[model samples]
Target: MLIDKPLPELRRYRGRNPRPADFTRYWREALRELDATPVQPELVPNREIDVPGVECFDLWFTGVGGARVYAKYLRPKAPIGRRHPAVLQFHGYSGNSGDWLGKVPYVAAGFCVAALDCRGQGGRSTDAGAVQGNTLNGHIIRGLDDPDDRKLLFRSLYLDTVQLARVVMSRPEVNPDRLGAMGASQGGGLTLACAALEPRIRRAAPVYPFLCDYQRVWEMDLAKDAYAELRDYFRRFDPCHEREADVFRKLGYIDCQHLAPMIKGEILMYTGLMDQICPPSTQFAAYNHIRARKEMVLYPDFGHEWLPGEADRTLRFMLPLAR
Candidate 1:
């Protein structure tokens, strides 16, 4: 189906974000009813690992429960260093840290980078001269029919996100206070959650983040994973739209928007105006509720292709603080 629909009301507030709330109102409520859960960490410290110009180690941490999450600790070689600012990196939906294997701009810029592997997604860690660590990684779009299921599903994604981040910050060579988060698409959504849920996060840079306004985005657009799950859900049970909505209501309980407000830090969110995959209105819903220092870069023509000069622009905004 074509991707165009009358979205819920998204209006601007006086000297603030849109107050004329819509779907976010209900979604945020459910997230609150379910208290923020702590992410558990299982350190795989100092295992000999190799990347490009930098050396790295693998850190395996459990998500909400036994959900094994992976992260790569990348660092520029420095024989003498006690503390350095760290950047917790996340990959897009269905991507892994290896996708960023060659991007040494961050570490070369003098920041410790920990690119986290989204649990259940395809691919495994195969660093040079390092033992391979492979396991059953679940897809995020699975088990969308209910919250108890999502708490188990998303909890792994969310916790692996923060726990690896926590490990990055706790490193003897990194400053825990100067920690920040960045990602695109689904990773962007996880970035929002990590910054909010992890108190150690001082700043965030999310580009074309998915998972902001969940119910609303799912309603207007139909894509893959998150959106496809909903579409198939309705397809299988056409009898009860109410049942699907109920499931969504429960899922919203753990969404990033509800968690964004709790994060007190600087935020830089990049959004595409015509993005069908992640409707702009959904981005605003979360952007507005942020009670932190923030800004948005809205692209008029961009759909989701890493915006022209967006990588540099995003880093420019972040450098004022992160550097």
Candidate 2:
């Protein structure tokens, strides 16, 4: 049973969510603030996951608000004269940078890999937690009640992605022109955000991205799982939906759909029509706004979980850039 619009309609779907009038200006100012912040980066060698051809290091950098960010960095051991491409990875919501072994393939493919541990999640990265609202279920609602949009948790998280890109691009062994990004679900959303905020990202692969079309998800009554916090916030704070417009408007500050138009990188989105956790329509809401060279791999019967060979395909999609 498909849970969203059919493929034909999905192609033409423009989404029902409202894009804030000052969306572009808001992000421009945010990035300006992020750029002004001092990113004092540090790298320490890690022996636990060392392998044959890749050097593993614990990467730390200061992000916006002075919170420290963490990432697992693997630089490939190529000839001294050779410069390698790099990939920045974002993980699913509430998750950390995955085990070191998972990044080996990219390292073996002559790519330096840096997987981020998002702020306040299941990773070593720190969450400053100075918001004004319910900090209960999800990061989406962390600063919803704050008078200032700068206090939003996702604002900092999104800026963290940009800072990591800057860090990776600064490496002497890496080619800044060949940097790419990959992630699924929340990571997928961050992938979009990173590419949008960091124009240097040349390629992006986002699988079933979350944090898009929040109003559409709410109207469809599908805000239960990863979006459960959205529903819970309303139930507890605005029981009668008095300030609904303001709530969604505030969320616009972090919505990936609004950010999509800023992405200049080539995009390849992986989506399953049956993905209830992040519905197909919601995924398309962001995809439709992408003005870059882009394509989508549709899984007609798949859900939010793994799609067979998706990893292989993504690797192949990025493989051409190695040359």
Candidate 3:
């Protein structure tokens, strides 16, 4: 089923959401706040997960709004007096970073790996939320009622990605110039955000990313799954569509599509055309805006879930950072 525009049209789709007039300035100020925020990073060794050649730790750092962000860090136990490349991983929406064993292969291949557990999700990271509105299902709608756009939950989450990279780069044994990021779904959105915010990120791989063009997703009526909260928010709060324009305008501040042009890293994005969850065009809306060296892998037969061999392909694509 063709869920979006044909591939050719998808290539040219800029996005349906309007970019706020102060979009650039808004992000600059947000980044400035991150710059001023002190990330008191702490790394505690996880003795139970250690292997002969790999070391694991529970990584924590202070993020925007003073949230204590969490991640799983792994590195080669014995580096041969040389710096190693690093990879940042973000998990799907509402999910924690997976077990330490999942990150071993990268460490085995001589790269330091850090996987983030998004704040307030099913993880150790602190949300530190003080929003004015709905505290329900969606992070998308969180703090929408606040007069301050900076209070948006995803804004803080996006900043957390950059904070994690900053923390990772500060390590003595990691190569600052060879950093990469990867994730699927919400994590994929974050991968793009992280690379866009931190231009030093050398590469990024985002598979079927969520949180792109919010209005487009609503128009396509694909807002019932991972985006169910978008629909729910409307049903309960604005049943007459009286606040439609205002709502989307607020969401524009955190949209990944708006952030794509700022990315300098080489991007390898994956999309499944049959995807009903995030929808294919929503993914392309962000991808088409990326001006850096980029490529897309299309799965005409797949959806938002598994696209076979994607894990191996991503591993190979990012492995070059270690070179």
Candidate 4:
């Protein structure tokens, strides 16, 4: 949660001159960036896990090279009237998949929800409470062999999120048109990127997302991974400085700044002024770049903790946002 951000007033761009173009460009870029391997997840239902009238299950999402990723999907047990709108949820970087177990708000509000487990992360239902106890190595930068591979490395986790949502939409009980994405911290960043990259998502809410403004993330040295990964990459390989810059530029091209605007759905971005992990300026940068109709909630004192009564506010906001 430690961030070395600069003075906020300095970077705050009150003058909005440039506008992000459209989602089409980002969508195509994501497709190009993704591998065309036969990626699929084997979803096995879990009748044991109890979710209020919603059948929840564990899913095994296979990544590009047959990497096994985990996910959890929840659907209304019995179809009520027509199919219900669905929400695919992701988790924070310092956290894992099951963190989204509290997503009953949307279900109780009459919707299906899919909460996915990020790979190399523990807090999966099968491995609950394991990583939290371990004073650990930074897993976010696990595959930082090269800067170009960082985003590619995150692909498995992010694609699992996107594909799991697509899987949920493939269900007869889910209203694909109403599908949306939501997450907090790193999850929030993923929510934004997934909403932008995955065109199917009609609504999005990114809360204190990580991995934005790569340059700033390195500057702040927030959590390890990113900086740690880059440092290690440069250290071990001693790659050309120019090569590293080019790699970061490509990474920036795939940055949330370029993608947030592409999300045509109603977006709700939330951040805290005191947030060390995600500086307010960077949050605002992404928010300002969001070309779609959106809303933002600023919490002055709250740090990494969940904002009190935020679910109600989100419900109220999303209920009316039936775009």
Candidates' RMSD to native? 6.3, 2.2, 2.2, 5.5
Off by over 4 Å in 2: 130-136
Candidate 3's residue-wise lDDT over 171-258, tens digit each? 9889999999999999999999999999999999999999999999999988887889889998989999998998999999989999
TM per candidate: 0.78, 0.96, 0.96, 0.78
Q: Write the per-residue lDDT of candidate 1 for residues 1-323, one digit (tens) a residue.
A: 32333233442411111222243454343344333434455545453545555766666654444445577777777777656778888888767876445546777776788888765554463311132444333343345544444343564566556667766776788878888888898878989988876767888999877776556756565435445655665667654676755555555645677677778879988877677777777777777778899988867677767688878875665564445
Q: What is the Cα-based lDDT of residue 138 in candidate 1?
A: 33
For model 2, residues 1-323, the per-residue Cα lDDT tens digits are 65788788888887777777888888889999988999999999998876899899999998988888899999987778677899999999878999999999999998999999988878888776533222335699988988887788899999999999999999989998999999999999999999999999999999999999899899889989899999999999999999999899888888898899999999999998889999898889899999999999999889999999899999998987788
Q: Across residues 144-249, which tens digit of lDDT does each residue of candidate 4 receive?
A: 4444443444544555566676678777777778877888877888898888767778778888777666655555555244336556655556555545554455
Worst 10 residues of 4 by lDDT: 126-135
Cα lDDT of candidate 4 equals 0.63
The C-alpha local distance difference test score for the whole of candidate 1 amounts to 0.65
TM-score of decoy 1 = 0.78
lDDT of 4 at 176: 79
Error of 3 at 198 (Å): 0.5
lDDT of each: 0.65, 0.90, 0.90, 0.63
Give RMSD (Å) of candidate 2 vs. truth: 2.2
- CA RMSD (A), model 3: 2.2
Candidate 4 similarity to native, TM-score: 0.78
Report the poorest 10 consecutive residues by lDDT, candidate 1. 13-22
